[model samples]
Target: MSDAQFVQIVGAVYEHSPWVAERVVSQRPFASAEALRSAMRRAVQQAGEAQQIKLVRAHPELAGTAAARGEMTAASTSEQGGAGLNQLTPEELARLQSLNARYSEKFGFPFVMAVRGHDRQAIFAAMTQRLNNDRDTELRNSLEQIDRVVSFRLNDLISG
Candidate 1:
């Protein structure tokens, strides 16, 4: 596939960063979808700290202002909705807001996770557990989470 079409398919895998897919497209005809995913993850990982931080920060908060305004990208809207984040009651929304605010303040970005298989309670528990981590640890964990999210997205787009 051409770079443009390739980016369209994989761009949302990294939140709003199509450039991640754009960079990987040159290494086309991946032996397997997994190989393509690894290259995408590595591109972000090998980036300077500033770039990595920006990539992480590009993600919207769960039920955040973007969600409130219905401004999330299609991929994010689906992911958040599938996690039942879009179904929270007022009290739960408040709880998430509090946790999100604190997490972003402490870590300099939204809490990152592959929430596809998790419920609200589980996500909350993770947020609480991860809040105590040092900055370096949290940043690394965020990248890992990004990798998992991308993997899920790739599976949808590629059979292998």
Candidate 2:
């Protein structure tokens, strides 16, 4: 893929961090979709603890202010919408915000998830369960979710 297209494809995959794509652009002519994904994963891994947290935090809370105001990226909007986060009732939105505030307070980052096959109940259950985890564990889980999100994006934009 051309440089611009490469960035266009993977940039939103990493939340607002186009630098992830920019950093990996020179390593292009990716052998396969998985190869491209691994390169993106390594970019996050190499970013170290602080940067990793920053990247995770770059994501807006599901059905929160960004979604309500329509300020989220198109990819994020669609992902959250797919999970039914976009259609929450006021009570549901309040519950999610309460959970989100608690989760962020505990982990210092927003709860991250792929949200493809998940519904609001599953998401709330996961959020409540994940809140019990220690910081490091939650961070690892966040990275795994980010990987899943990236993979989904790659599968959408790139073909093997």
Candidate 3:
């Protein structure tokens, strides 16, 4: 795709995911690929509380439940279930489910991650580790990670 088409797709994606709308729209007509990436990182860094919440909500749940409903991307769904969250055997699934339930209940949302290349055990460990964070810090970190994931995905979409 040309730069203009890339801009359009990025803009639409930002709008579709409201969390990134203002940032994506505001940084239109990027002069270089690096500039576009920098803008995205800055957008996430400067995102307000509401935008952050929207971003978190846009991500699939930790156990891949929301993903199966088409609310999340197919690639994310597969990654979450097939690897990062998938290593749990039935017993382990139950244990992780308990942990996930507790974590979400504490945070008011499901645990979110960009699990493109993670294994289930690794994700599980990360989940446990992240649960140690206070709500504010974890929320910020999670959204930043989501923005990174989206940016990478956008680059792929545009390049292809």
Candidate 4:
């Protein structure tokens, strides 16, 4: 992508999302991917609780079949669709579905993780373990995990 396109993604992220925009817009003219991610983490730390909630809401849930948020492009959608939960083997898929049902029933939202490189078993393990976290604790933990995803994606957006 052209530098203009790269910057546009940043702008797009900022336009619809205020927390990121507030942290990044002033730091514009980023020199490198590292610089952008550094700025992102700092911004997340500086973000208030409400802003953190907004950021958390921007992430896609871990459901294999659901569309990821912030992935507006057809390519992103196609990629995630192919990686849907049903892609797992029958046993693993069933386990994930059960775990997901239990998790959502507890939290009132879908269980979420950045499943970029992880497989079904790993996801199941994470879900099962994280299920033990209390409501407030898990909410914060999940949000931190999402910040990692946002940081990675922001890095790719700026540098690729």
Candidate 5:
């Protein structure tokens, strides 16, 4: 496939960051799904701190304003909803909002987790516990979470 066509298929695997796909276009014809995954991840790793931060910032806060106003991307909406975030009670919503605010305030980016396979309680615990981490640790953790999310997305897009 042409580069544009390839990107159109997988560009969104990394949330709003199509650059991740674009960056690896020159390295096409990956021998296997794992190679494609590795190339995409290496692009992010080599993208430098500013770009990496921007990529992380592109993710919507879980159950944050984007979810409230119905603005999150379809993938995010599905993932969040699958975690029962779309069905939070008022108290739970309020608590989550508070946690999100505090976490964002401290880290300058929304808390991220690969919400699939996790319920609301697990998500909350992770957010709360991660709040104690230093910026470097949290940034690394967020990127790792993004990788997990991307892996799921890639799996859905690619088949054996």
Candidate 6:
């Protein structure tokens, strides 16, 4: 397939950061799913700290402003809804908002989680716990979480 078509198919695996896919387009025809996933991860890892942070910042916070205003990408909307983020109680929403603010304040980026099999309480607990982590650790953890999310997205887009 052409590079453009390849990107169109998987560019969104990393939320708004299509550059990850764009970077690896020249290395197409991956031998297996794991190969493709690894290339994508390498793209992010080699993108430098600034771009890595930008990639993490591209993700919408769980049930944050984007979700509230219905502005998140369709994949994000569905993934977050599956975690019951769309059905939060008022108190739950407020608490999450507070946590989001604090986390962003500390880390300079919104908190990110795969959120596929997790519920709101689990997400809350994770946010609270991750708040204690230093910036370097949180950045690494956030990228790892993005990898998990990208893995799920790639699975949904590909078949054996």
Per candidate, the number of residue pairs that clash is 0, 0, 3, 1, 0, 0
lDDT of 5 by residue, 1-160 (tens): 8889888888989988999999999997899878999999999999998898899999999999999899999999999999999999999999999999999999998899999999999999999999999999999999999999999988988852
Give the TM-scores of the predictions, in the order they appear. Answer: 0.95, 0.94, 0.77, 0.69, 0.97, 0.97
What is the Cα-based TM-score of model 6?
0.97
Error in Å for residue 52 of model 4: 1.5
Comparing 2 and 5 by TM-score, which wins? Answer: 5
Report how far off residue 158 is in candidate 5 (Å). Answer: 1.1
**Tens digits of lDDT, candidate 1, 17-124:** 888988788888899988988898889988888999999999889889999999987778888899999999999999999999999999999998988989899999
Model 3 clash pairs are 83-120, 84-119, 84-120
CA lDDT of every candidate: 0.89, 0.90, 0.67, 0.61, 0.93, 0.93
Mind giving the per-residue lDDT tens digits that candidate 4 earns over 1-160? 4555544566443314544645576667678766776786678768877676566555445543444234443323433444565355677666776887887778765565766666656777889999998877777786666655556566555456
- What does the lDDT read for residue 116 in candidate 3? 72
Provide the lDDT at 47 for model 4.
Answer: 81
RMSD of 3: 3.4
Model 1: ten consecutive residues of lowest lDDT: 151-160
Candidate 4 global CA lDDT score: 0.61
Model 6: weakest 10-residue lDDT segment is: 151-160
Kindly list the per-residue Cα lDDT of model 3 for residues 16-128, writing each as its tens digit: 46335445655567797667767776776677777667767666666656543556555565556666464567777777778778778888766777767777777778888
Candidate 6 residue 147 Cα shift, in angstroms, is 0.1
Q: Cα RMSD to native, each candidate?
A: 1.4, 1.6, 3.4, 4.4, 1.1, 1.1
